[model samples]
Target: MSNELYIEKNGAIATIVINRPQKKNAFTLAMFKELGALLDELETDKNVKVLVVRGVDETAFSAGADISEFLEVRFSAEKAKKYNDFALESIEKLYRFSKPTIALIQGLAIGGGLELASSCDFRFAAENSKLGITAANIGIVYNLTSTKRLYNLIGLSKTKELLYTAKLISANEGKEIGLIDYVYSSEEIEEKCFEFAKQIIQKSSVAISGMKKVIQSVVDGENEESEAISEIILASYCSDDYKEGIQAFMEKRKPNF
Candidate 1:
């Protein structure tokens, strides 16, 4: 994996840090490729129960794609298409990740940055964080998948307003509009993120994974009565975690999940 995108595992929680503080963690094409590869590995790594994505510092979650590389790397239609495809693959992986995912946003989360945050299952932003999708300002259309994710999170009206205006909203506004799940002061954001992750890790992994799959299916418009959904429900019922949970409740003890 590229140094720009590194992972730090702490027991059940794996934190993916976007390390480009000098550039406000702006993603390069290589960074996208690395992220896609890392997600592939983490998805199969049963030890990682929760994933948190964040920038290395409090300055910015990400300034989005590095525009300085535009002329050299994305000046031509063919090149731009390839570049976008790389990012799309990475974003899709994050969106479809089976494990619980969270985005810890601190400062600026604009354009692609906002897209990255939206890909996660939950977004927790610092009170002063600024988030927006600014592709409209640069005369480029946002990717369809990212747009759909944003629309799903904040609804059609708010999504349209953000895209059309290209204005960054405060973290509080983001929470109000459903772009973020929670907001904390900048100093407390990281600590609060870990606290949230701890709560998630304490849950049964089997149930969490099953829930993630079923939720994704529903979001994709699959009916709850589908056979695939039923199969997942059945598997969860048969899992050891389920029995353990029942035993713990009866015994009045915390379950070791």
Candidate 2:
């Protein structure tokens, strides 16, 4: 993995830190590739039940994609499409991750960074943090997947306001607009994020994963199929963990599975 992204594991919780503090943790092509790899690892790593993503420094969750690299990489239309594709793959992995995910926003979360946070299941931000989608400023059209994610979180009206204005909004404003789930002081952001993650970890992993998929299905308009719900129920019933859960409950003990 590139040094641009760092992974720290703490039992059931895993934190992925964007390490390019000098560039406000802006993601480069290399960082995007590393992020995809990291997600792949986390998916199969049963020990990691919840994932938290944050920038290395409190200065910015990320200022967005590294524009410095974009100059050379996005010079041509074809190249720009390829570059965007790389980022799309990484972001989509996070969007569709089976486990519960959280975005810990400390500072500026702009452009693609804002999109990354939107992909997560929940976002927690420092009171001083700023969030915005700035694709309009760069003359790029937001893709369908990204637009859907943002619109789903904040609704079309608010999503358009942010995209059209390209203005940074306060953390509190973000929460009010439903962009972030909670806002805390800078001093308390990290503590609050961990506490949130701990609470999430206490829940059943199977149930969480199932709910994640079902929610996505609903958002994607696939939940109308009765088979979708049935599949989740059937999978849960046949899971070894489910059996263990029942045995544990009958035995009056915590599940060890």
Candidate 3:
């Protein structure tokens, strides 16, 4: 797609970089479709087992929906819905991606940026990064999909505090509230986060993907053992990864999976 948003692959790990550093990696309406299409492409790629989403540099992860486009794109209810659908598709895909995703934030992750980071399985932010949702500041209401993701990550009261205040929180504060999974120095964030992604890819992809689905089902209010969930749990026994795991244990070696 556009150079403004592109993917960089390294072995089993692939990263989608938000490249508009000048705009703090702000995403325009068109970039949303490009992002969704990239996710679609990556989903079918056998070689990619982990995805990392980040900005071009350590300045910012993203500023969220480019405010400059709001006049033309979200000036009315119908226009807003059309525009939001593009973003919803991309973020939802990232949320339910078959593989794992990590969002590495450095300077800023506010507005839709914070929401996008919240969608990832893991969020690693630099020590002094600024994060928040500023929809209130612009007189715009945050969409439910984005709101629910934040709510799931940080819970009800904290989510309300964030939305109501429109205040930026520190990385440490984010961790304390469960919004950030890891915090490191700006210099250490990338190295540590990518190392984390590498570690995950070394595990069994089959197990990881299955658990992702099960965990999401639970998040969506599935508490009981449904037949579909049971099937996923049972099907693992027949997967090649399971066979290799058993063989490796017997042979006292690490599994190739």
Candidate 4:
């Protein structure tokens, strides 16, 4: 409902922009609710084939939680949990989103910002971007889900090194360490993201959606050969999208999936 988290749709692509440039797009408690609501809507929106989460400008993806609110809103453990619940809702929604999701990082994706990017299926960073998990610097422990996501990206040793040092790494270094997927020049990052999205949008949405779940299951340490995985595979094979894919290959033309 608030403009802090707003959606802009172009055809089947939906971009959720964090609008708090004055604070480098740092998220507030209310903004998290708005983001969660948007994610909920997009999750069930069949028309949305791809989703991109980005900051309002090239200044930053997000600087993490607004600590300014801590004194008034999260001073106690009870209040802290409630504050965390809002963030967890939004982050988990993004992490478990069925469709393809991308975090287009520009500059200063630190602390919770890095965690947010880790939740996406892909992270595309601008060449000038800086990324790190800064909770340790402030004497706070990262949440389990966020820790798991970060661990999945950079592994145990690097995760330790990152949390211990709380140092910012360049976009290229982030990509090398598996924290980010791709990096482009600052001026070209947004355009490159759309180009990447176009490649995904041309595929079979049903197949992609199914695979995303299966892959996430594996990432979560679920058995890939389990009955649930089989069911998902069977459903995809039985889908019209599968037939279209086969037919298009035989016909030697592009598939309109």
Candidate 5:
């Protein structure tokens, strides 16, 4: 009912915060709708080259969906399906977002929270954080699309082990299993995540976006159309960024790619 989702802009980066700290940032129906709309706005905002998602407090990224609302709104089979569809739309929007995305995990990323992080291009968590996919414990089933996203990042075996057991794994274990890209001390997580994003922004956005599309196509088992690949290559070659990159190299200067 409140402004559960907050957006903050920092130059080329945008941070989306799940703001209901008292509930461990548990997402409500309104929060899901707000997230979808925010993501839609970001998609057309070319100045935003990177996006970071995080919880307001350091205790939890999101405990899960708002359980209190479930009884009243998602109790029936038909309503549950509709609810799932609405939540899934927001998740999918993040999954296919054009620019690079990072999950700045400060604490527990559980259930739907983990699914949300998995949708991002990269995840960086604090050393003391824990993550798990716990649909089994709640007597609900994870949708096929969410399962595919998790499987693609961590492999089917690891995905199954996490889901079937419904156990929380440490940040270290998450990194070992490829669930998280990097882990940092709680004291340094925010700075570290922004540093990582800055490094990524120094690279060619055109190339980064092209690779994202190719990776998504491969994950979706779509045919790699030669024409599409050719277009990407040609567009990158012709962009002003490409010219600046080459001239900067010849001049021994850092490229503003």
Candidate 6:
């Protein structure tokens, strides 16, 4: 991975930090490729039970794609399509990552930054953070997958309002509109994020991962009891984690997942 992006593992929780703070953590195409690769490795790493994505500093989560490379990577239809495809692959991976994922927005989360956060299972932002998508301002249409994610999240009208205006909303407003799951002061955001992650890590990974897929399937318009969904439910019932959980519950002790 580039020095601008790296992963830190702490027991069951893994964090991918975007470190180009000098550019407000704006991601270059190289960085996006590195991010996509990292997610691939972490996807099957059993040691990781939760994943958190954040900028290295509180200044900004990311200013979106680096405009400096636009002339080189997005100046033509062919080039832009390739560039967007690379970035979206990573975003889609994060969206479908089996583990619980969280995006911690300490500051600005604009354009692609907001899409990154929206892809995660939870979006926690600092009270002072700002977030929005800016495709309208640049005269470019937002891609369908990211647009659909936002539509599923904030609903059609709110998604339309956000995409059309290109206005960054405050973290509180984001939370109020269901764009943000939690918000806190800069001093507390990271600490609170881990606290929540620890809580998640304490749960049954089998159940959590299975439910994550089931939820995503539902969001993607799957029926309540698709064969795949039933398989997930059935597999969970036969998991060692389920057996241990029941035993611990009867024995009045915390179950080790």
Model 5: per-residue lDDT, tens digit, 29-97? 778888999999988998888999999979888877888899987999999988888999999999999
Error of 1 at 202 (Å): 0.7
lDDT of 1: 0.92
lDDT scores of the candidates, listed in order: 0.92, 0.90, 0.93, 0.90, 0.89, 0.93
Candidate 4 stretches with Cα past 4 Å from truth are none
* Candidate 2 local Cα displacement, residue 131, angstroms: 0.5
For model 3, the superposed segments whose C-alpha errors exceed 4 Å read none
TM-score of 3: 0.98
Writing each residue's lDDT as its tens digit, candidate 6 over 1-257 gives 57899999999999999999999999899988999999999998999999999999999999899988999889999999999999999999999999999999988999888889999999999999999998888889999999998988899999999998999899999999899999999999999999999999999999999989888888888776888789889999999999999999999999999
Question: What tens digits encode model 1's per-residue C-alpha lDDT throughout 1-257?
Answer: 56899999999999999999999999988898999999999999999999999999898999899998989888898999999999999999999999999999999999888888999999999998999989888889887888888988999999999999999899999999999999999889889999999999999999998888888888999875588778989988899999999999999999989
Minimum summed lDDT over a 10-residue window in model 1 is located at 222-231
Q: Tens digit of lDDT per residue, candidate 3, span 71-137?
A: 9998999999999888898889999899999999989999888888999999999998999999999
C-alpha TM-score for every candidate: 0.97, 0.94, 0.98, 0.97, 0.95, 0.98
Those runs of model 5 whose alpha carbons end farther than 4 Å from true positions after fitting are: none
Residue ranges of candidate 2 with Cα displaced over 4 Å: 226-229, 247-257
